[model samples]
Target chain A: MNRYIKLVNFEISRFIKLYFVLIAITVISQVTGTIMISSQYVNSASEAIYQHGVSIEQFITERGLMSMFQVTASLWFLGPIALCIAALIFYTFFIWYRDWFAKNTFIYRLLMLPTARINIYLAKATSIFLLVLGLVALQLFLIPLLSTILKWIVPVDLRLDMSVTELIDSFFYLQIILPQSFVEFLIYYGIGFMVVFIVFTAILFERSFRLKGILLGGVYGILSIAIFTMPFFIFIDYLYPIELLAVETVLGLIVAAMSIWVSHYLLTKKVMV
Target chain B: MIEIKEITKKFGRKKVLNGVSFTAEKGEITCIIGVNGVGKTTILNAIMNLTPVNSGQILINGEKIHKGSYENVTFIPDAMTMLPQMTISQAMEFMQDFYNTWNQKRASEILGFFKLKESDRISELSKGNKAKVNLLLGLAMDVDFILMDEPFSGIDIFSREQIAEVFTSHLIEDRGVIITTHEIGDIEHLIDKVVLLDQGVVLKEFNSEEMRETEGKSVVDVMREVFKA
Candidate 1:
């Protein structure tokens, strides 16, 4: 456990130190966008409702503005996807250049380290997870700052009675706000992302084969999803009264889990260089 | 002590290793000499559990080493290219954190012996110095068996001599070492047993003294005749 902690800490610290400038740029963009949008909403609230024939209170309640703020504060799903892309691009270039520079270095040497392979995998995954989470936290911090700034510009009547502490509490809850039915869905999504990379890396390790593993894994992943859901789709046409969202969510989770599990098994057991 | 029993590895139709077997006793150096594509490095990979074998098993100190038992082994390959962005000290710190058997004091001594400064980034070091660092890390591990695949392939003569001394004086004591290399002149005096391989088969297994006395030939000469090189 101590070794695992040290390994994860090492990875996280290295990533933050190496990419602080990029992270700072992302945060600055997010903060600027959040402040601009919130100020616009505050300024146009009265006009939007009375002149535009839109009931502000009803629209806000129905659309769940509070929940939307929380979700947007966490950068929604798009934030994680963006972060993943950035990480993938950075690591891809970094790994490629490093391997090219040191042609004779084998992956077997890394496997010989006196720690569990699973721990190494987990450390890297955790670094990605925490980096995304840290960016979300930064976005959340800007909400209160934006709110305070808007209050000075606009009258007090237009501003909602939301405090930074309240906003933080809501944001914290939003972090785990998924329903029990969707919990597995989110978990599987995260695992599926991890597996895609694991398979890609395993293939790379096999012979330093370029992008074949990733490409193959992607094809396999899509095939697996199709195979898993095609039967359900066929059956669902007959059982027209079924709860489609619930059934789809459950099936998606199962398929994602199976794909990730298979990917990891193949990576650990069959990978060679 | 390390023992490899009847190991076979096949990639589809091509047999990389075919029912090969050997053993290394404690406090002795076992050298594996083979032509290119003869599975010398494959054997090391199999023993280290870096690659799975199609058949047979590997044991260290009479205990089986396999997928679930990977922690009991250590291996140093021919050449390593670490993250070029890392300094020597940073890499050492990473090794110290990851390996339970890492000896910081010995690692420091070796760094000093090689005249490698802590602040030097891996990219700044020459290929020979990089190879020396790889050797030093392998030696610093308190493992029962150290498997090195072509340890001196890209190193300079002076660094090779320094590494050879480190291997003879401090690395091989109450622990088994298996080195695969073509450069026999640097390590011939240190090796106790020699295993000759050709095309995935063991052609000969002889003790160093026995080969010298009976054949009146050095290991290099024997290899030259065996491979017809």
Candidate 2:
């Protein structure tokens, strides 16, 4: 267990540089985005009330108060969020492949470690989990700060003050990041976790068998997704909503277990350095 | 004792190791000698379980090798295994973090002996120095057996001499070692045992000094006699 944590830290340290860059990109792009979007909204409001001879009430009724939702809706805002999502997705595969294909084969050292090989797999998974959580946490902290920036630019009458939760509720992706409840958080992230393992097992399949394994790995991934969602299609009309959630959770755990088992077997019996 | 019993391995359809077997007892330096691509590194990788075997078993101290086997054995592959961004000290810290077998005293000694700076990043080191660091990491471990694959390959003559000098010193004393190298002349006098391999099979295994005494043939002569035939 101690080794597991150390391995996780080691894995984190390897990518921490690129991770910092990712964080910096998010901060720069999003903050810049908030300032620009708010200034534009205020400029438009000014144009309506002062230049066009419209009443303040008319302008406010016409355009509504500038909330964080509008800022979040723009390409300036959504672009970085999309970029972060894409970056995290790309890292899921890069985390594994980087060790194998680096200047020196770090996978050799990892494989030859004195602890269970599963620790290596689990550590990499845990690192990815922590990275996703870290970015979410950053966004959580950034939301209030960004709202403050919006308030500084847009006048009180021209803007609507929103709590972080209210802001998140209005945006589709933020709700996914910061789920409304603990159970929802587990359900969403649990499926994400299983997909990460499925892909890991697929990678192991490829590592074990090379060319033929690539085909085998793709089939395995598709098959895992098929198994996880089978209950949804088969029992869609038969089960209650709560019962279906329970069934889906159980099925997801089973798929994750199977992936971990296959990964263990390959690492022990079939994988080559 | 480390035993390789009739181990066979195949890559796709080509046989890499065919019923190749040998044993190395503690406190002896055993050299696996063969021309390039004759399953030398494959055998070492098999013993360490870095790669799987098609059939047969490898035993350490009369038990099959497993995950825990790494605590008592270390494999120093030809290339550097430490990440390039890490300084030499950071790499040492990594090893010390993972393995209970790590010996800091010996590690420091080797660091000094090889003239490697603790602050030098692994990526910046010369090939010879990188190889030294690779060897240093393995040798600093207090394991019972050490497997090295072509440690001397691609090294400068002076560096190779320095590494050969290490074998003769007390650093590797009383430990089982299985080293594979095609360049036999460098450590010919240092190794105590020899396993001559060709075409994925062991042609001969003998005590080097005994062969030198009774058959009056050096390692090269024995290799010439076995491989040529």
Candidate 3:
């Protein structure tokens, strides 16, 4: 168990620098974006009301604060969110491949460790999980900071102060990131873990068999997705919405188990350093 | 005792190790010598279970080798096994963390003997120093057996001498070592047994001393005869 922790920490150390860069990119782009858009709204409103001799009430009523919020979310937040997701997905494969493709074959050392080989797999998975959660937590903290930036740029009278929850509910992606309830959060992140595991298993397949493994990995990935969602398609019409979710969750767990099992077998029996 | 019995391996349709078998007991150094493209490295990998074997068993002390069996063994491949970004100290700590058999005192001694500083990053080290670090990682472990694959393949003469010095040192005294190398000159005197491989088969397995005294032939002489035919 302690060895697994060390393995996890070792894995995390490899990518922690890149992770920080990702965070910095997210923080800089999103904050700058919020400030720029809010400043633009304030300047445009001032021009309409004062320079053009229009009423402040008419200006405020015409461009609703809700519209300002929507614009800010769409223009700035979405890009960073998408970028984070894409980077993480790329890293899921990179974490495994980097060890093999690096100047030194770090995979050899990892495979020869005096613990169960499954610990290596679990540790890498845990590190990816921790990274995703860390970024999620960072993004969650940024929401309030961004809201403050919006409040600072736009005057009190012109601003509509919405709670963080309200802001999250307003956007589709935000809702996915910061789900309404704990169960929803678990379900979302569980799926994320499943995706990471499936990709990891695919990479193991590729590594073990070389060119043939590439084809095998792709097929394995598709099969994993199918298995995870099999319950949904099979009982879509017969089951209630809640029952469907329950069955889907059960199937998802089974798929996760299978993915880990296949990965363990490959690592132990087939993988070559 | 380490017993590899009739191990067979293939990559695609090409057979790499065809029914290869050998044994290395504790307190002896076994050298697997063969030309390039032979199954030298693959044999070590198969022993460590780093690569799959199609048929046969690798037994350590009468039991089939398993994941937990690594506690008794360590492997140093031809290439650097540590991450390039890691400093010597970090790499040592990583080994210490994973293997309970890790001996920090011995590791530090080797570091001092090799004149490798703790702050040195693996990527910054020369090819020879990288090889030293790889050797240090394996030698520091208090295991019964150590497997080295082409440790002297690419390095300066000075580094090769330094690495060869390790063979005579007390560092490897009682351990069963299986080293794969075509260059047999460096540790020729240190090898107790030699297994000559060619075309995925073990052509001959003989005691080095017996070859020297009775057979009146050097490993190179035996190799010339084996490959000539």
Q: Evaluated with TM-score, which candidate comes out highest?
A: 2
Candidate 2's DockQ is 0.87
i-RMSD per candidate, Å:
3.1, 0.8, 1.1
> Which candidate, 2 or 3, has the higher DockQ?
2
Per residue, candidate 2 scores C-alpha lDDT tens digits across B1-229 of 9999999999988998999888999999999998867499899888888899999999999988877888899999987898998899999999998889999999999998999999999999999999999999999999999999998999899999999988988889799999999969879899999998888999999999999999899999988989999
Q: Pick the candidate with the highest DockQ.
A: 2
Q: What is the DockQ for all candidates, taken in turn?
A: 0.37, 0.87, 0.86
Local lDDT at A266 for model 2:
91
Query: Candidate 3: deviation at residue A61, Å?
Result: 3.4
Chain A accuracy of model 3 expressed as TM-score: 0.95
Of candidates 3 and 2, the better by TM-score: 2
Model 1 spans > 4 angstroms off: A31-106, A147-220, A223-264, B11-13, B67-71
Off by over 4 Å in 3: A66-68
CA shift of B173, model 3, Å: 1.4
